[model samples]
Target: MTAIDWADYATGDKNAASRTLLMREFLRRAALWVDHLGGSERWPFFDIAERVDSSVRADPDLLERLDEFTNANVPEFIARRMCRAAVHWAELRESTEVTLPDLPDPYEPLIVLYERGGVFFVENGVADFEMRRVPLRTWQANLAPEPVVEIDQAVLDAANEEVH
Candidate 1:
C-alpha cells in the first residue's frame, strides 16, 4: 500500500491557497509597475522589468501553468480586483500605453520583449519599455580618457548583423 501524504493540504490545497498564490503573482507584477513602484521617486519601471524578465526566462513552465492555476484557484473577483487595483494604481494599466523599459512605446507583453526589441513592452501596465541605442561604456576605471569610453553608434547598426 502507498503511504499517506497530507503534505498537499499543509503546503497548499484548497481555494484559499490558490488565491494566495495568484494574488502573490499579481502583486509581484504590480510591484514592478512604476505606479506601484513604491510611493516615491523610482527609476524607470521598464528598467526593472528587464531584470525581472531575464530571471524569469529560466523557469519557462511558470507561464504555462499560470492559466490552470488561476482558473482553478483564482476567481473572477480576484482577477478583476487585481486588474482594477493595477489600473487604479496606474492609469496605464487601464490605458493601452502600458509597457516595459528599453521599449519606448507601449507593447503587447514581455514575450515580445524577448523577441524583436522593436516591440513595445508592458510591465504591470504602469510603465513602458522602448528599444534605444545605449553606449556600452567601459568599466575600466574610475576616470578614463574620452575615447576609452566613447559613444559608439555602430552598436545599433550591428544589432541586425548578429555575428562578427
Candidate 2:
C-alpha cells in the first residue's frame, strides 16, 4: 500500500467550516468586484480579463484599469478553480481513510433575514387593491403595483431621484 500524504491532499484546511468560510469570502469578494465594475458600467462579466489584458498590453499606462478589471472578474475565474482544487483535495483525503465532516447548515431560518428585494421579496404581502379609503369605480382610477418584470434598477433609480 502506498503511503498517503495528508498534507498534499488537503487544501490547506480539513475543517469544513474553514472551507465554507473561504468559499463565502471568495463569493463576497466577487460580489464587491461586480459592484465596483458596475460603477464603471462594466458588467455581465463577459471577456473582462481579455479586454483589460489586451488594453493594458497596448497601453501600459492603463495598468490600474487592468488591475480593477481583473479584481472585478476574479469571482468568475476563481470560483471554478477553487472548486476543482477542493474536489481533488477531497478525493485524495477520501482515499486515505479520512472521513469528511458533515457541514450541516442549520441557518435556514436566517435566510429570510438576509433576503434581498429581487430574490427573496415576497409578492404575497402586496394587495391587489389599495388599502386606502379612495374608491375607484372607473378603469383608470385603479391602483396596482407594477408588474415584477418591468420593475428593475432603472425603475428604482427613477423613484430615488424624486426623493432627493
Candidate 3:
C-alpha cells in the first residue's frame, strides 16, 4: 500500500484540512479501483476521469487544492493532459461528439502503485524499448532461481528410522 503525507499535497493549507482529507480518501478509493481493474495499463481511465470531474465540480475548494498540487508537483504537459482527459471523459459520458485527445499518463501515487503491482505505463501506448521482439523462452531463461530448502541430516535420519 502507498503511504501519502497528506500535508505535502495540502502545503500548509490548514484551513482546508477537511478537504484535503476528502481528497486523500478519494485517491485511496481510486487506487483501489485501479487495483481491481488490473493496474494502470488496463485501467479504465475514462470512468475515473469522469469521477474526478464530478468531484471537482461538486467542490470548488477541492479543485483549488488540486490545482495547487498539480502546478507544484505535476509537469505542465502532464497537467494539461489530465485536464484534457477529464474533458474527454465528460464528452464520452454525455454522448457528445468525441474529439480524441492523447490519453493522460498516470502520475505520482498512481505511477508508484502500478509499478509496485508490476504494471508499467508506456507513453503513447508505445514502449521505448523493443520488448515485443524478445522471445518468451529467452525471458524465462533470465528468471531468478527458485528457492531451495536446507534440511539437517540428523533430522532426516531420525525421520527415516522412525518410518522404518
Candidate 4:
C-alpha cells in the first residue's frame, strides 16, 4: 500500500513523486519495524511517531540546539552524546526526515537540482542519498541563485601572508 518502498525504488524524484511526508516516514519505519517485530512490516509512520516523539522529548536539552542548528550532534560530537545517552545511532537521530543543504551557487541549476533530490551530473541509480541532507539549515523549497566566486588561490595566499 506504500507509494515508494526504500527497498523497492532505489532512485526517483522524491519531490516529484512524494505527495505526503508520511510516505517517506513509512519507508524508514517499516524497515526498522520489519527488523524488530516481523510480519514483513505494515502501516508504520503512525505507529512510530509516538516512540520517536517520546524519544526526542526525553532529550529536551538538545531541543534548542537541534532546532537552531539542524544538527543535534555533529559527527565530531555525536560519539560523545551517544556514549552519554547510551543509545545507538538510529535512536540518537529522531527523524530520517533529512534536512536540506544550501546550494554552493544559486546560478548553478545543477546544484539546485542536486539539492532538490534531483541530479543531472551524477547518476544516483544505486542510491537515494538526498544531497539536500548535506546542509540542513538552508531550507528553501525553490531555487533562488545568487552567485559569488571566491578569490583565486594566489590572492588568498597573498592575503594570508600579509596577515601572518
Q: Which candidate is the best by TM-score?
A: 3
Q: TM-score of every model?
A: 0.22, 0.23, 0.28, 0.21
Poorest lDDT segment (10 consecutive residues) of candidate 4: 134-143
Stretches off by above 4 angstroms in model 4 are 1-14, 18-32, 38-42, 46-58, 67-164
TM-score of 2: 0.23
Clashes (backbone N, CA, C under 3 Å), per candidate, total 17, 0, 0, 3
Per-residue lDDT over 70-137 for candidate 3, one digit per residue giving the tens place of the 0 to 100 score: 55544434333444444444444455333323322223333332222222223553211113211112
What are the RMSD figures for all models against the true structure? Answer: 18.5, 22.6, 18.0, 19.1
lDDT tens digits, residues 14-44, model 1?
2222222222232233333433334323322
Q: Across residues 1-164, which tens digit of lDDT does each residue of candidate 2 receive?
A: 01212122222212222223222332233333333334324222122223223222223344445445434443334322332333333343334343333322112111211111101111342211112111212222221222211223344344434434
Clashing pairs in 4: 100-135, 101-135, 106-145
Deviation from truth (RMSD, Å), model 1: 18.5
Supply candidate 1's per-residue lDDT for 65: 54
lDDT of each: 0.28, 0.27, 0.34, 0.28
Ordered by lDDT, highest first, the candidates read 3, 4, 1, 2
Which candidate comes out best when scored by lDDT? 3
Error of 4 at 87 (Å): 11
Model 4: per-residue Cα lDDT over 1-164, one tens digit each: 01112132223334422211212222332344334333332232123323334343335564444433423322223212322332222242434553213222111221222233322111222122333222111112112232222223443334334533
